[model samples]
Target: MSDSLAEHVHYLGLANRSDLYRSAISDCIAPDDTVADLGCGVGVLGIFCLEVGASHVWGIDSSDAIYLAQETVRKAGLDKHYTCIASSTFRAELAEPVDALICDHIGYFGIDYGIIDMVRDAAKRMLKPGGAIMPDKLVLQIAGVSSDACHEKAAAWSDDIVPKVFHWIDEQARNTKYPHEFAPGELCSAPVELGQITLNADTPEYFSFEAEIEITSSGRFDGLAGWFKSHLGNDVWMTNSPLDPNGIKRSQAFFPIARPFDVQRGDRISVTIRARPEGNFLAWDITPRGGPTQKQSNWATTILAEADRATLDGPLRLNDNAQASQYILSLVDGQRTAAQIEETVMRDRPDLMPSQQGTRNLVRDILKRCAVS
Candidate 1:
């Protein structure tokens, strides 16, 4: 194994294995049962299970930790019953279904190793119907707040320059890769670091989860960190935070301001995260420090025509209210031309008229995108 995998395996050395031990003891494994250890790391948890009387253990990992696990198995004189494979959970290549599956290869936000999805798929293909899984589910939670410091930090890091020098530089670097991953959208304004994440779990089911969070910063909130919860079974819950409690630190997905607005302190920023067959999405809000007076997307109402939507594709993150999306939607009847739709929409929604020419131009752009091949 190379040094990189070795280092990755060594990370298990830092894990607080007390949770694994407790879960193993409480779950009640038989003397001759089989276990498949996913993301086995140095195989400490699997080795620990053998110490506690498990009959057979198979350890799998993507890192160099498999070598360490094999060494540990050999030293313990359990070579017959304990084995190690240096591979990912998605391709463990094991021949037999096991009685239990053990995995702790999760990051702060929980899906970093792609192990959760792997395990979910594995349970469907590899495990027997009566088998148990340890550390099953994880959950995420969030709160909102206002802060000058957070705003300043975003401004400092954002690409909002007045004279346009930085914008040109940004354009040059559009195709270049960064040391870290950047979001799909351009940075319209500054952003704030929402919070950190922590891990907590161990139970039945392939996976199971919950999160409790305290929000510190608040603003006219635009986006948020993705938090998640997994349920191992009805019994165990795990939490994944963008504000990671472990040393693993990386950026969270950016949540753009659905509508531009002002936010204040003490506002409750509440969010819930769940999984779907497709992918993950989040809905969030910040209560005005005051009462409900104006909706957040009022700027959109002014700029968007009934037949238009914004071109949110690039740095500007334009709104669809501009007659883009709706115009295309309207064109489906094939009876009305783009110009006709613009005229009708203008008549119905006068608020969209910054000017007549602008409306015509917006409609023209939409029709251009909707032009059939």
Candidate 2:
């Protein structure tokens, strides 16, 4: 495993936050119930289920951590009761329906990792008619925050650089989403529940939410701070909100405004958030009371320059690159193998395929993308 992934697994394995999950599993699992543990890192939750008297547990994870999960089950002498599948829970199939579905796919804020869609699909496919889902509901919370330190960290690339270079770098950074930690004192407004999703029911992949937050203190509004509250089971829940005294140690989402604005205690901040499950994109528009609206999206941070926007909006046509791709694709007539195609392309278009190794790589990439499975 990569060092980062190993460290992540190790940290999560030892996080005190996991105690909430263990307690919930112990309280919810029945003696004869079968559990499906999605994204089961080290099989900890699955083994906990077995220890709590679950009949069996199916642990699924797409990473190499699944092997460690299997090993953990064996070490616990519960190998006969736990089965680890080294595949994404979305793609894996179960022979029998499970009595409960357990997953810890929630990202830093809440739905950043596409857990909403994953859990919804698992409930439809692998869950029994009346099966329960851990963390049955999720609530997304948002509040206006005044944190010059956090804003400076995000906008660091804009300093001491040429205008064009800084714009490019800033654009790239804004396009990419990141989790940011916020100190309690940074909160400028009371939190508002933006949205909620019940995991046991079918849900749309796209969600739109709008909420108005009342500014509780006077400060500059630099961005919106976001967190999540997950209901694990009866009277068992976990949250990352700084306002929650019992909240876990987790990063919060900070959606920065293009420009900071001052606000008073009575001013209101209106927020509209649109979420796309496929790319985990979050688009937000903030309109402070009597202030101009500012729009930002996680996928594309800033509005493109006029010239760039015009070029992108222009009609599409095949260029020299497209013509070359067409020629290469024409060579795949189902009669010649990929090797033969590469040889012919190398001989005919040496300008595109300069080296034999490069030609092989180009052909392999083309086939991997265009070949019929």
Task: Quantify all predictions' global Cα lDDT against the true fold.
Answer: 0.50, 0.81
Cα TM-score per model: 0.50, 0.79
Q: Candidate 2 — which residues are off by over 4 angstroms?
A: 3-7, 10-15, 161-164, 301-373
Error of 1 at 28 (Å): 4.2
Clashes of each: 50, 0
Write one digit per residue (lDDT tens) for candidate 1, span 214-268: 3334335443334344444345444433333532233333323333355443343
Best by lDDT: 2
